[model samples]
Target: MASIFTKIVKGEIPCYKIAEDDNYLAFLDVNPNAKGHTLCIPKQEINKIFDMEEDHYLGLMQFSRKIAKALEKTINCKRVGVAVVGLEVPHVHVHLIPLHDMDDMRFQRKVSLAQEEFEAIAKEISKNL
Candidate 1:
């Protein structure tokens, strides 16, 4: 079965896209931690980050770095935090969160944002790219 992220990558589902390249895709999280929170994933569906081949792992990070740089420029935050908690979905993904404080990245906390707000943030981040 195709993972939800793969559906987004394949355009079976819509996404608030931030950026993309040949091997990776970056888009806003539908349920975001912060205003500019984004999800970065490989185009290829790998169950675990460590399971990816050496070249794919290296390329994914490099691709994510570009998105993170643009996200930092567009969002107001102390820093951008990266997290990988792959249990929620079967596919490998990295969460790029705009961190104003340590608590901004907490998984235990509930976070919510409207779709329109996510779209606006996605556009803002896209503009910086």
Candidate 2:
């Protein structure tokens, strides 16, 4: 079965995209932690981050670092935080969140954004990218 992130990558579902290259895709999280929270994933589905080949794993990090830089440029938060907890989804994903404080990193809190807001945030991040 394909993961939801896989569906987004294959265009089976829509996403507010921030950046994409042949190997990776970055998009705004619909249910965000802080505004501008984005998910960076490999185009190839891998169940675990450590399971990825060394080069591929490094590629994802390099790819994510680019998105995080863009997020920092686009958002007003103190800095961007990185998280990787594959429990919620089968595919590997790197979470880049705009953090205002410690709570931003906690999964307990969720932020809701309208479609327009998601689109705008995606655009701003992409522009920075």
Candidate 3:
């Protein structure tokens, strides 16, 4: 079965896209931790980040770095925090969160945003790319 990220990448599901390349995709999290919170994933569906081949792994980070740099410039935060908690979905993904403080990255906290708000944030990040 295709993972949800794959569905988003393929346009089976709608996403607030931030950036993309031939090998990777970056989009905003609908249920975001912060205004510009985004998820970066490889076009290939690998179950674990470590399971990816060396070149793919390196490409993924390089791809993500581009998005992170844009996120830092666009979002109101000190830094963009990276996190990988693979259990939520079967596909490998990295979370790029705009961190104003330590609590901004907490996975246990509940965060919510309207679809329009997410779309606006996505547009802002995309413009910075």
Candidate No. with top TM-score: 2
Which of the two, 1 or 3, has more lDDT?
A: 1
Clashing pairs in 3: none
lDDT ranking of the models: 2, 1, 3
lDDT of 1 by residue, 1-129 (tens): 999999999999999998998899999888777778889999999999999999999999988889999999999999999999999999999999989888879965546888787788889888888
TM-score to native of every candidate shown: 0.95, 0.99, 0.95
- Name the 10 consecutive residues with the lowest summed lDDT in model 1: 107-116
Residue pair clashes in candidate 2: none
Please give, for residues 1-129, the per-residue lDDT of candidate 2 as tens digits. 999999999999999999999999999888889999999999999999999999999999999999999999999999999999999999999999999999999988999888999999999999998
Residue 51 miss distance in model 1 (angstroms)? 0.6
Q: Judged by lDDT against the true structure, how good is candidate 1? A: 0.90
For residue 52, what is the lDDT in candidate 2? Answer: 100
* lDDT of model 3 at position 4: 96
lDDT score, residue 110, model 1?
A: 45
Between candidates 1 and 2, name the one with more favorable TM-score. 2
lDDT of 3 by residue, 71-128 (tens): 9888888999999989999999999999988888997554788888888888888898
Alpha-carbon deviation at 112 in model 3, angstroms: 2.2
Off by over 4 Å in 3: none
